[model samples]
Target: MLAGKYSTLGAMPTERTFAMIKPDGVRRGLTAEILRRIELKGYRTVGLKLYQIPRETAESHYGEHSAKPFFGELVDFITSGPVVAIALEGENAIAGWRSMMGATNPANAAPGTIRGDFATSVGENVTHGSDSPESAQRELALFFAEGELLK
Candidate 1:
């Protein structure tokens, strides 16, 4: 379900999207900076956590890429360290976060975006965001238990 606090503009429904600060972001101590940007964008953080990703969970999370040769590497790197999982609610959150994160590869990202500012490579890009409403629901479910996020 779409979730968020009401906007002052009157009943403008906001959507919930799942976002992540990858291991590199956490290790580099960019969590606060990243979160600050999120809040500045007017997105409400419904839930947040800091933890390590389990192997099985990582596999499940990247299941769609299982057939790709890089799947195993993806799972390994993500599970190697702690990550920050965030549930954000805002107008066009899915698209907004993606834009804010910039391109998957830092090389092609805009100068003001997160990846562009911090990432040096595509494999260890700083952040992750749900690409669509359906993916948002699935991802949010994987990381959060029912009622865990403020509504």
Candidate 2:
């Protein structure tokens, strides 16, 4: 399937999940490996693209974290290089991607995960996944224009 818009169960796929490879992932050439894992998990990629996030977009995307000390660093890191953003469809995909991504800090992440396999620091965790369904929808809207990623 191109972008997995649903699962076999036909539960209507609660909500879409959004994921993005950080600058480090692109610089290290881990994009294929990361996408492979997502495909292997049986989820469908509804949308995929390689683009550099503008500073404004990055700021809005991480706006909730603006008050945090690392917010500026987060924005800068995300905009530092090209990133691959994906829209995934499947049951519980938001949570699933988060699990697949492991912990926020690679040091705490379990082995056999994308972060565990490639990341070395919390700031460069390699990928970003939607924390909730609402955010997933919001983020999908932010990164993908209408019809940009098909189901």
Index of the highest-lDDT prediction? 1
**Compared with the true structure, what per-residue lDDT tens digits does model 1 show for residues 65-148?**
999999999999999899999999998899999999999999999999999999989999989999999999999999998999
Q: Against the true structure, candidate 1 has what lDDT?
A: 0.94
lDDT by residue for model 2 (50-119), tens: 9999999999999999999989999999999999999998778988999999998888899998888899
* Clashes within 3 Å, all models in order: 0, 4
Q: lDDT per model, in order?
A: 0.94, 0.90
Off by over 4 Å in 1: 1-13
Candidate with maximal TM-score: 1
**On a 0 to 100 scale, what is the lDDT of residue 12 in model 1?**
49
Please identify model 2 stretches exceeding 4 Å from their true place: 1-14
Quote the positional error of residue 140 for candidate 1 in Å.
0.3
Cα TM-score of candidate 2? 0.90
